[model samples]
Target: MYLIAIAWMYVVVMMTIAEAASPGGTLLGAFFTLVLYGLLPLSILLYILGTPARKRRIKARQAQEAPAEGHPPSGTSSGVAPDARSQPPAAAQTDSVSPVREES
Candidate 1:
């Protein structure tokens, strides 16, 4: 990758030099040509090339994490404590509340 970047830099430098030397081309035109034709396309190409590797790395990291997450601490089998685990769900407490009647 470094070699490719260095080679591209050399190509751009040579192009800019040639443009500047040409009777019809200005230094400003050379700068724009290097930015528009050279750097922009190279940047897009590098991004497209790197995307799959980036996604693979992310998936590999997630896969590594999944196993670690599967097993819990020895002290706690479930996320809740032993005492809390014995209790019924909070939603079951609705029996103790009186329902409100709507007034028209």
Candidate 2:
């Protein structure tokens, strides 16, 4: 995946450089060439090639989750009860810290 992305970038950079070096080629023209000829096709190719991998990952995740779906989640690994996890501590419940300081 990374290799494809890197290779695409290299090709695009080289193409941009070539376009910039061509007779009567402006930097703006090079930019447009890079976008049109390099990035557009590369992006489309990556998306098409990546579809199956993405689908497989999603399917694997769903399969792993299916078994655990029927069971209720247990308490935290640290042994904190469900009740403690549901509520904030007493200090956090009140706005004890004032933003403005009174002049002495």
Measured by TM-score, the strongest candidate is 2
> Which residue pairs in model 2 clash with each other?
none
Task: Find the candidate with the highest lDDT and give its number.
Answer: 1
Error of 1 at 64 (Å): 2.6
Taken over the whole model, the C-alpha lDDT of each candidate is: 0.77, 0.76
lDDT measured at residue 26 in model 1 versus the true structure, 0 to 100: 100
Tell me the lDDT of candidate 1.
Answer: 0.77
Candidate 1: clashing residue pairs, number: 0
TM-scores for all candidates? 0.55, 0.56
Worst 10 residues of 1 by lDDT: 72-81
Tens-place lDDT digits, model 2, residues 1-104: 76977888898899889889999888998999888877888889889998999999997887778557753334333233335557644544666776997799
